[model samples]
Target chain A: MADASYPDGLLYHPEHDWAQIDGETATFGITWFAQDALGEVVFFDPPQVGVQVTQGESYAEVESVKAVSDVIAPLSGEIVEVNADLADAPERINDDPYGEGWMVKVKLADAGEQQGLMDAAAYQAQLG
Target chain B: MVAAPSDTLRRTALFDRHVAAGARLVPFAGWEMPVQYAGVRAEHLAVRARAGVFDVSHMGEVETRGPGALAFLQRMLSNDVSQIAVGGAQYSVLCREDGGVLDDLFTYRLADDRFLTVTNAANHAKDLAWLRAHADGFDVQLADRLDDYAMLAVQGPAARELLAPLADGPLPARFHTAELTVAGVPALVCGTGYTGEDGVELLCAPAGAPAIWDAVLAAGVVPAGLAARDTLRLEACFHLYGNDLMESRGPIEAGLGWCCKEATGFVGAEAVAAARAAGPAERLVPFAFTGPGIPRQGNAVVGGGEVTSGTLSPCLGVGVGMAYVPAERAVVATEIEIDVRGKVRPAVVADKPLYRKAA
Candidate 1:
């Protein structure tokens, strides 16, 4: 987590979010850059499963010791699952942002929304 | 979208060192200061358990000199300035004539006819102008020492031990100061700190600060930042200028009556005495969450008060904060509910220090 990483095959949002796509489902989480900027996250108020999420809108809130940041949704979907483990160990967001740190899994409302996201290389370039 | 540059923010003498330490720099009181290095919890724990060094160079200093210095400061400061012996440090508040707190400061008696008062960065300019405007009748000279020195606070149980070897002579005891050569640089080491920990605050020349800072870090002192400083001070129940202490409230209401000597006849003495005799309507008290949820500034209390400062105490592992509530309900065991955002979080008024060292 100390080094900046942007895994390929993951779509990136300008707000520093990532979406890992499956058949019709996708896992969403903030990117390494976002987590690094937020410092050590102490709290993650996860959104409830079965809630609707709109792309470009905040679905959850992440709090560090000194600040609170809004975690935006990268794509529109119906949230099917929330990462309950983060309730007590929000630091995972900084440790494994792409894996266990994934915030929510959603059933995509429109897979076509992926067109708006950037690839890993493009996201890295944006970060630069 | 790209973020805008913080070009207008001022930098301290140790800014480069903070950057090299991978600190999270943030704008504080118009200065680009390190909010945290490593992490707030880590830095906070480091200071509590061992020694931690802080770049407090942003804090301002004012020098009052001349034969009338004592009388002039006695009129301006809320505490009994006449009692501070040479080499002694006294904490006091500057108040408006109407009893509003201007700023909380620590004045060190450097000499019989000279004193140095450290001021909050945000209120330094206003405090300077206020002192200068009132210098008409008094034969005192006020010099702004804001840029003349860089401040570093080495704090914790092992603070003295960590700083001793590099010091040319012995460090000052608590609430005292001594001039010494630290890391080969001339410095005024004051035995004081905001963190309720044993420590010395070093005021050194700007040019020599980087070397001193590096030497302290080299001595195993964890580099802490403003975020850790806030948590540590809050755990100690120390009043933060903008939060716990404010112009809208007098020192008595802010639980600082012990430092206020109305007989000294300082500015706002009459109003403070009146407030003291009659008692303040609201009293600032430290509180901790009985349940979950961190209380934050401006969060409304269920009753007639509001939280002024709050955080998840790194030491206590619980939500702790200070609030101003009706004096009647400020008792230590009184239960209070804070409206955090929209949800009500249960809390109880605790002792002055919400966190204490384990026995």
Candidate 2:
């Protein structure tokens, strides 16, 4: 598993989810702290590409060998793409939480939702 | 689930050792326990390949003594107690009059008129109460040894090798016990384990546990935690109390009839005999995922039945579990579908053990 590090330039949700916002679109994945707690994620159940997801709601499920956890959505949007590679190798979530572990690409319902999120420093502070 | 206060949870003798080893502590059966050290899969594989040690101090123990010990146990336990010679260990279940399993246990005959029975952590109090209630008619003395001793189970292919050097005397044979001084501390070492491998379970003074634990670790045994212990027992098709064996199920339905000798006239003998003759409505069987996805406890079987225990087998690299299916569906290779939350996962009934070492 990778070391605990939350790269900057990403918006964070208190649920340990992160988003890379680019205008009206955003890429979503769980934060490093999230994956570490989940422990060597063995399975990732991704949402369908065209499904609409609500902010602060569970959109997918991730399982470790011992337990299963819901993957909460950070913001409302229509899923445009999913990280299909996770189907074969879900450990990427623990190995590279921010990059190859990205869960879904979403077309934002309201980019204004980003205002409720925290910057890296603010999110790290809330964790404390 | 609400988290219990850390101060309210009980700590074992090895609590500090686990924290120092960087183990992840979680609340289990009202005790603060290490769920994993390095990781579940790593520790599980270690037990399968070499050896691993587990602090099982949270488990409870009941000591039965006096001249009526043997006869008393015959009526209390499901197995034929007379068959167990001194120093021998035997497995059996404590059942209610209706054949409902109270707890599965291992009883070791310590002497001609004394025996030690191990109980599950959560069910210890209840088991002790049940045993005591039935002691009125028998000439046996019952003592709760829950806090009198600490337990450490060292299991795997090289488990015996790990302890033989530190032990002052020869280790006991399978299903037997021997008194020995291990690591300069007196211990009762039993040649038994639940990991589907050759191993020994050491019972010693609570204060002497650290020395034995340290000596075993220094022998290169991995510090396995509850997570690995669960996975390993599941692979071995061993029934876990709350998951597989419950008050709603009987030993016959749980596929534990082999240990039930109705002729012995145990507490639930009549009920067990009736179940054996008429057959159970449901039967528990081991299974493995036929494709993708992992099965979990409470996942409903497609038509009839429920999964009791499930996990990703570290050795087989697939989802494996035990489920109670319609009696007719218990045949080996029978196909079944499990509803893991919403998804339909296909699985097949397998042989008793889901993971076995290559011959």
The number of the candidate with the highest DockQ is 2
lDDT of 2 at A78: 98
- As a whole number from 0 to 100, the lDDT of residue B193 in candidate 1 is 99
- Assign candidate 2 its CAPRI class: medium
Clashing residue pairs, backbone N/CA/C < 3 A, model 2: none
Quick one: best lDDT, which candidate? Answer: 2
Candidate 2 regions off by >4 Å? Answer: B1-5
Instruction: Tell how far residue B78 is off in model 2, in angstroms.
Output: 0.2
- Candidate 2 per-residue lDDT over residues B303-340, each given as its tens digit: 99999999988899888999999999999999999999
Let me know the TM-score candidate 1 reaches against the reference structure: 0.95
TM-score of 2: 0.98
Off by over 4 Å in 1: B1-5
RMSD of 1: 1.9
Q: How badly does each model clash, as a count of residue pairs?
A: 0, 0
Residue-level lDDT of model 1, residues B1-359, one tens digit each, is 22354889999999899989998788889899998888898999999999999999999999999999999999999999999999999999999998999999999999999999999999999999999988889999999999998999999999999899999999999999999999999999999999999999999899999989999999999999999999999999999999999999999999999999999999999999999999999999999998767778899989789999998899887788999999999999999999987779999999977888877
